[model samples]
Target: MHTSSARDAARIRVCHIVHSGKVGGVEVAAALLQAEQHPSINYQVAVLAQLPDGEPQAIKAPDCVGHGLNNPLSVLPVLKWLHRNAPDIVVASLWRSVLVGMVAKLINPKRKFVIFLHNTQYKNVLDRAAHRLGFRLADGIFCDAPATRQAMTAELPLETGQIHVVPLVARGGRSRHTPEAEQGPVGAVAGGEIRCVFWGRLAKQKRLDRAVHLLAELNNRATVPVRLDLLGPDEGELDEMLRLARSLGVEQQLHWHGAADWGRIRDVASGASFFIQLSDFEGLGMAAVEAMQLGLVPVVTPVGQIAEFTSDGVNALHFDSAAPVAERMLSVVGEPPMWERMSAAAVAEWSGQEDLSTAFETVCRQFLANQQANAANHVIRGAVS
Candidate 1:
């Protein structure tokens, strides 16, 4: 993919390589960064895997390159493509993309390699090994949260200025009112019904089963009816979660909306009482931020970067135990004033975040300029010798 801007021909060109073009946080962030249209930079995405149809993406059609990774020979074309385009900076997101970028760097050592690490912990031994190798070859690094930066610093041999924490802000979702919009004095819920939402892959780490349990407990305690909307594609936990919901007799209350676009999710969640994510771990909890933008107070465990922005009882509710979280839900259900305050606070918290695209452009431009200086200095030393 080439940036055909003749006026901006001298601008820094960046190629972002991703493992896949799926609708995940990493992919979404890459898409948002491309949409920023930084004046000094031209951005394109090279997806390692074939892009599936109908995925809600902000990336321009002409600027994206996708090649399916089924065959071992698949990477050869990507390497060839890199050689043809020769971007000034190659930004690799995730470990898989890092490996691709490493090969691209080896092919042409002059190009700077930047690694974007999204998670605090590795998924397995293979992931750990890839991350170690990727970081070793990276000229600069981007971390989604301060927690991820600290974790990578301890695990990898990284210098202080190499890592930049640029948390992803909500970009795609549609919100009708501003955070300062006046919420109902009584509460967001209406007609004795409380609607809750959870969006992300339906996986074990997300603790959707725990959310189902909380739903049952909340229904038992509150006089109103509580419903939960489960969004995102299933990641092998649907069957088990469904069985649990059946056993608990709350299957009727749980609505499953798989892999929805941002607008659809926001539309479904507009009047929802709470957005719940009981995940065991997270980097920055992008979905929760999106939920907050929709004016739904978050009920999340204080894990990952979630603890940094969310103020329990002020902006959002915190989770320690399912029973306790359910109790808090009931408390809010009864106290309409408290519910209104939290709803407004949740939106306000999201409103205060930095625009992700602007932050990323600043960080990436600085990283490239610094790397160019180092290269020039090395050349000067060689000439002196």
Candidate 2:
């Protein structure tokens, strides 16, 4: 049996309340942070919905309150849990969790609350209104990237002091490309098949149709056969994307691996060449970073923090009407020197990031320290008065 020492018992308790316990970048990031062994932080993940079963879990969630987001009683269970457990701090991960955390703080104003911003775009007007109101009640905010923080402050009444930019580090993956291979002469590998991979939700914002078009264009230009792999759960665009690929006569070249964990992704994508994500917007484009960690050059639209980190024709190929995405990709495909250089650059960029668990702990402790300082000042002023 395991037991806590006095020092361990004295550590700050942190509960990250998330909307769902399913496998995705946000949920996986939260789960990994919770699993990290910290000397001064005891982390717990509480999902609004029941923990999912029999599906490939990215990381096992710790707690489930048995409530759904749309249910009117959703906040009550979370509030009740907060009261029963009395964690020292609550970090709400998504917009829905923000509402629950805001309500809990209103009822128990002594507890500290923080918001972890995940995206740069709002789902709707309702989401925008809720964030504007809910964020005002948060003690602090941690954004996935600077772009997320900038977008929030630009539209909402948020101060720069209240927000912190802490990029999430990629969970490790297998490296497929080597520096020697990258430095080779310009051309396709002898008898090699060109493979491209995309790992994210099949949603409209991802614009997967554009990926299919790119595939057709690549095959049209290349002497070798080209294939595209799609990974992640279908978020209502599967049928349309399949039909479009069929119409373009590239259905055979499209591979679908639904809702995969990181291990599975590495196993399947290890030999892949390019990681493609032309999302309309992203907080940090985490999957792209993950791909980079594996030495896969990115062919992404320069939006959100993707623009901040990637350099066009240097580490990545950026397309935004300056030229078609296919044209940019073809430029890399025909030039082994350029492709190898980009691959090496992508790997080096991600390897330079801080360790994942340490980054999370640092951000959480900063928020806790600030809250304690503020509380101490308030008490001192009261005693003086």
Candidate 3:
């Protein structure tokens, strides 16, 4: 991918390589960082795959080099493209992108490599091997969460100083927990329904079917009328989820929100009493974190970094299955004081978090300085020789 600004002598160019040109959490994070990054740094993206029609645009910022390879077989072309327009630094995101980035780095050893480790688990064996290779080959690593960094350190034989943990923060941050504009009038009651919100891709990893069953159990076993506003794009599993909800007689109670934009999600979150997700596992659980920062009580599974921040009855409730999840749900709804206390704790958890954009900038600057020092040392050695 060519960054025309790279030739401007005053600019420092960096590019992020990812598997797809779709609007997912990582893509959103990259877009946010590109928009908020230092003006002198020229940022671009090399999407490894061409996303299908109707998919959200991967790169949101203007003047971006959206390099999407049409097929996996075109690996040579991708490498040639990287070699032709080598950025000062290339950040590889996800396991697949890591593989591509490692190959590109081998072909063009002059460019600095940074692996963006976002997932704690790489399910594919070959991908996992490639991920480790990329980590070992990179000049630095940026972990999405502390837990992710710990996993990499424990399993991969790598230097600890090369890894940096940067926890992601939601946009539109505030000083304290406050009511959102989309929320009902403070303490207002309408139809006595408890509004629950869930956001993430509609796939098996999310375990949203668990959410449907939990809602049914909550409605059947408790006094509160529970309704879930399931937000996110369907990844070929929404049909099965709807069927399961219908079989359990919860079809009417479920609200299907298809791929809501960030602004719309913020509004929905403002009015929600609790945000719930029981994903099989999460790398960082950014969606859940966003909801918690909005002052919504979290009913999340103890997965990934979620367990590090949320306590069972303090900041968030834990839910592994239908029975226990319903029990916790009812407990939160029945006791207003209990949830209020949890809400305060939840806000406190994210109260003093450093802006994620600033964290990214800090790492980029630190690594850039290292790259320069290494170059200078090589120059000195050359002169001595």
**TM-scores vs. true structure, each candidate:** 0.88, 0.88, 0.83
Per-residue lDDT for 1-385 in model 2, tens only? 5466777667778888887766778887876776665667777777777645777665565564636767758887777777777888888887778888888889888788888888888877877777777777888888999998888766655443456777786565322222344322121222368888898888888989888888888877777888998889888999999999899899999999888886677766776778889888889888888877777788898888999889888888886642377777766767777788888888777765665566777877777777777778779999999
lDDT values for all models: 0.75, 0.76, 0.72
Model 2 lDDT, full chain set = 0.76
User: Rank by lDDT, descending?
Assistant: 2, 1, 3
Off by over 4 Å in 2: 1-3, 154-161, 173-191, 321-323, 376-385
Root-mean-square deviation of each candidate, in angstroms? 4.0, 4.5, 4.9
Off by over 4 Å in 1: 1-6, 51-66, 172-187, 373-385
The number of the candidate with the highest lDDT is 2
By the TM-score metric, which is better: model 2 or model 3? 2
Q: Least accurate stretch of 10 residues (summed lDDT) in model 1?
A: 178-187
**Candidate 2 global TM-score:** 0.88
**Least accurate 10 contiguous residues by lDDT in model 2:** 182-191
**What TM-score does structure 1 among the candidates reach?**
0.88
